[model samples]
Target: MITRKRGAYTGRNKSSAYKDLVWTVATTKDTTLPLETQIQETLQIIDDNLKELHSNKHQIVSAQVYLANIKDKPVMDEIWKKWIGDNPDHWPQRACLGVDLEGDVLIEISVTAVADL
Candidate 1:
């Protein structure tokens, strides 16, 4: 079975979690900020979306984070540590990669999770 949870954002909720899937994407970017600032902001957005999914029956199974610069990994890791510390149990398969960003954005993530049957 599948279902869509709705809340608030612009047009639709920021996240979508199905009975057997967890769909999460980072919120809009802070274009004027530095790379580190953007990365932290993006992580916070991910956290909020993940928390909403946790309120339902699904659990995060994996996360793929993208960065605009590989050299910024250290800074990104620092923020990631703090975020993960808050909800240790929700840890999922994770990976980070360096790639060309869409625009002024420095970070983005796509997460997958599973809802209990």
Candidate 2:
């Protein structure tokens, strides 16, 4: 079965114990917020939507990040570490790169997670 929520989409099996979730990012035109702030807010949006599916899940399996400026990478790295934590075992497979993000945005992150069904 498949389900869509505010920030995440999920595929589930009633008899199975796991569900796959895809986080959807929000796009905005306002550029006044700091890059790190935007990243944090995006994560929170994903979190809020995930609550409708399962609330106790914490580990992410993979992530893809896009940044409008390579110059912002250092700053983004610092904030990402704080948000995703520093544990090696818990770290998800990730790919980050500088790109022309939408709406002149500084950054965007997409995550995939497996959670209890």
Candidate 3:
């Protein structure tokens, strides 16, 4: 029953935040790359954060993906499916939406996962 917080922010200061068994992460894609590459890059960021929390994709309980354009869903989905692999049982509940992300970021992802004990 440990609580950890990563990327916490207070008046311009930032750090990671976690609580109990769950860890959370939020990231945006590098718009300089193609949509597919952005998806890959975003997923990599998620993977890295999960690793830091002693978890992996399999432990993700839920996720929210934001796209600059809703039409990009299909392509993003394709990359997401590949990144998560073929294990349906390991999949998390997810949602995607169109948003106005900051900078040149075309995609953004936020995830919540259970940490490994």
Candidate 4:
């Protein structure tokens, strides 16, 4: 069976899970914010989404970061490193890509993790 968690954004599921894997994605609601703030907000949402799925950042196996500007990657990397932190167990195999996002969205992140069964 597949489980989908509802969210306030566009009638879409904030995260969806099948068996033991959960896929989640997030971006800041306030798209007008600067890159740093957007990233911060998006990560915070992902943190909550994971917890709701009985998972956490440490359980993330993969992450894909979408950026409106490729030049912002360095800054995004710094914030990401700080949040994911020093533990190897907390690090995910992540990739960042430059993409044209809707509106003023500076960054968006999608992750896949192992959720509690």
**lDDT-based ranking:** 4, 3, 1, 2
| Per-residue lDDT over 1-117 for candidate 3, one digit per residue giving the tens place of the 0 to 100 score | 445544534543111435534555555444688878888887887888777767888888888999998999999998999898898999999999999987878887888787776
Native-to-model Cα distance after best TM-score fit, residue 104 in candidate 2, in Å: 3.2
Q: Which candidate comes out best when scored by lDDT? A: 4
Superposed Cα RMSD, model 4:
1.1
Candidate number that wins on TM-score, 1 or 2: 2
List candidate 1 stretches off by more than 4 Å.
Answer: 4-14, 54-59, 86-89, 114-117
Model with the higher TM-score, candidate 2 or 4: 4
Clashes of 2: 0
Candidate with maximal TM-score? 4
- Superposed by TM-score, candidate 1 places the C-alpha of residue 9 at a distance from the truth, in angstroms, of 11
Identify the superior model by lDDT, candidate 1 or candidate 2: 1
Q: For candidate 1, lDDT tens digit of each residue in 10-60?
A: 676567766657677783466779876786787777766766666331266
| Regions more than 4 Å wrong, model 3 | 1-20
Candidate 3 matches the true fold with a TM-score of 0.82
* lDDT for each residue of candidate 4 in 60-113, tens digit (9 for 90 to 100): 999999999999999999999999999997899999999999999999999999
lDDT of candidate 2 over 1-117, digit per residue (tens): 656553222562211123455444443235668787777775665565445556321666777778898788788778778876767877788888889876757777666666655
